[model samples]
Target: MRGRNIKKAAYPYILWTALFVIAPMFLVMANAFSAADGSFTTANFARAFEPIYLAVMWRSVELAAVCTAICLLLGYPAAYFIARLRLKSRGALLFLVIVPMWMNFLLRTYAWLTILEKNGVINSALEFLGLPKLNLLYNSGAVVLGMVYNFLPFMILPLYTVLEKTDGTLVEAAQDLGASRAGVFFRVTLPLSLPGVLSGVTMVFMPAVTTFVESNLLGGNHFILIGNLIEQQFLTVYDWRFGSALSVILMLIILISMGAAELAGGAGEET
Candidate 1:
């Protein structure tokens, strides 16, 4: 009777998952394998894997990798520094990092657009100094910059959580053994933070790869990543099959990437 009641309590959650998560995925799979007229087909998958589309996918991965790396480089230090601060200061700094994310993502991207545009803030400042304007807007660099700006908090939060939770005793003991600061960080602190690093990398890279807004806003019309292509197919072209196929492929890639991250995290823990 008690087990039955427990199972009954889980029914709502199970139904919610079926209604939201499982149903949408089923719809996507059905559309991916169906034609516009509802006939079965595999052509969508074929088109999705075509040379041009594959190139777009590769570019997406490459840009996402770069963005993830930059976020890690910037975020890790920020997280570490914040972790080492006094409790009050740490809260304030961490709040600052998170506050930007509370704004709409599109608004944040639009803000970057203003900052990077030819006659925008940076260029205006440059002109004030009699310096030449940089071609900062509508480029790969701008796209990466926007991505890093938006996703950086994802990286920082995970790393900060891990670093802040790290036992001070281990670090103090290592110091007592005459370990240098660099040695302690490299051999102890960094290794201990591996789970956070892996989580941060996954969090940053996944959205970066699948983002269309940042690329569209910053990359202009010329730079078409996989996300843009998928958006085009679904919205502009009205090719649901192709769009669904691309979505499935992207989902698979993310699953693989997540698995790889888990393996890397496990290995780091062992080491």
Candidate 2:
């Protein structure tokens, strides 16, 4: 009776998932597989794979990969530093890392516009020093910078959680066995933190690949990534079928990437 009651309590959540999550996914699939006259078709998927659209997809993957690499490089050290700190200091620094995320995401991206525009903060500082104002905004570099800034914490927090829980005794044993600091870290710490590293990579890469806001705001019309292509199809060109196809393709790519990450993580754990 108690188990049945517990299952009953989950009914609302199941209903919510069906209504919001499953329904929308089904709708997208329906649109993806249908023509304008509502007849079933595969042309939308074929169109999504056209050379022009393929280039956009490639660019999106390239930028997302770069963003993920940067986040991993920067975040790993920061997370390690924090994990090694005293408890109170660790909490304080972690709080600082999370503070920016509390701000509205759009507002945070917009702030970069003020700092990166030709007449913005960086350029203004350079001009004050008699240096030439840079054309920083509306570029590929600006888009990557925005992605790194926003997604970095996602990388840091998971890594910190895993590193913090790492076995100190194992590290001490490695030192006792005459391992150098670098050797101990490479052999002990990194191997143990694989789960977090994989988690962080997935968290950062997935969003970065599909991010329209940062690319649209910072990249201008020069860099039309896959996300931007989908957005234009849906909103500007009013091609819902094509947009849905793009979304489905993106989803499949993400799922496959996630499966690979999961397998890697499991292998690491076994090793």
Candidate 3:
């Protein structure tokens, strides 16, 4: 009976690990390691380090990092507000934070396209206000905005979880000990919330860097992220070998980011 229960408990995790993580990763490695001669080769990865791909890759890292910073700056305030709320209103505020996530992601990007385009609602509104018309669409700024907008909830929710459950007595004790507000936040609240911040940062940055639709639609395909490069290699260029290599490289970047998050989390926990 105990054995059967143990198996049942482990079943879902095993299935998810295999289906979502293992299988897809194996496919990527297989494609990346195999060559055009149908033989094993590291040449595919060698191709990935070429200047053009590296440039796009660096751009992706920069973009994701910038978006992550924006999310943290904007989300931290909302989370702090929600954390300070009375219990009755907390649920409502959280609901508002998460509701947008229920809408289709692509649909949200499309909405941005309409609002930001030349002579669109914003431009018209500016014209009506007798302001200079701004052509804001189809640029890197719009892409960053879309990514930050889409992923903001992810940034907020984790931090909210950590901050909401924090020990109030510790905070009070710090205040009683004469720690200033900023000192308390930097020393107590911020450190205490590091787990959630790490989670939120990881949740925002990794996917933000890899988004294809936002850059394609809102960015006007003028800026090509690593995700966009991979898409081109597969769909437009029809070069699965190079695409697989790019995929492998992209995975490495995410892995590195996640590893750094984990290390930071561990260090914070140790403190």
Candidate 4:
């Protein structure tokens, strides 16, 4: 009676989730194998493997990997500082991390557009100081910069969550045992903090890889990532089948990464 009662109320919510979330995903998967005569076929998956599309997918992976690495380098210090701060100031530091996310993502992207434009603020400042103007916009550098700027909070928040809960006594214990400050960090703190690191990497990377808007606006559509390509196929080219295939491929890649992250976390815990 108790178990039956327990499932009674929860079953509808599960039904709703499966109907909304799982249904769409299954439809997309079905679309991946869709045919002109409305019969199931593997042709779409075969078509998705073409060199041009594969290159676009690969480019997206490469860019996301590089941007995630940069976020780790920059965000680790920021998260660490926030973690080490006194209790009263920690809230302020977290607010700083959060405030940017509340701002419109498009507005943030547009702000970079202004700064990176040829005769914009940066160039104007350079000219005022008798320095050469830089051509920075519409390049891979700009794409990465915009991505890092937007996704930084995602990295810091996850890392900070882990770091804030860290045991300071362990770090101090390392230092008292003839270990240098750097050694204590690398040996003790870092090993313990891998969950946060993994969380940050996954958070920054998936969105960065799949973000079409930043690349379109900042990179000037000169470069194409998988997101941009998928957008073009669905909206511009009117190829839902191909686009669905791309979406499935992208989803699968994300799933694989998430699974790996879970495995990594489990492995860390085991060791």
lDDT of 4 by residue, 85-112 (tens): 8998999989988998888999999999
Expressed as tens digits, the lDDT of each residue in 80-190 for candidate 3 is 889999998999999999898889999988888889988789999999999999979878899899999999999999999999998999899999999999989988999
lDDT of each: 0.95, 0.95, 0.91, 0.90
Displacement of the residue 88 alpha carbon in candidate 4, Å: 1.5
Tens digits of lDDT, candidate 1, 48-167: 888999999899989999999999999999999999999999999999999998999999999999999999999999999999999998889999999999999999999999999989
- The best candidate in terms of TM-score: 2
Q: What's the true lDDT of residue 202 in model 2?
A: 95
After TM-score superposition, the amount by which residue 244's alpha carbon in candidate 2 deviates from its true location, in angstroms, is 0.4
Full-model lDDT, candidate 1:
0.95
Model 1 TM-score (2 dp): 0.94
**Clashes by residue pair, model 4:** none
Q: Give all TM-scores, in the order shown.
A: 0.94, 0.97, 0.94, 0.91
Write down the TM-score for model 2: 0.97
lDDT of 4 at 94: 94
Compare candidates 1 and 2 on TM-score and give the better one: 2
Best by lDDT: 2
| Residue 264 accuracy (lDDT) in model 2 | 85
Candidates 2 and 4 compared: the better one by lDDT is: 2
Writing each residue's lDDT as its tens digit, candidate 2 over 49-73 gives 8999999998999999999999999
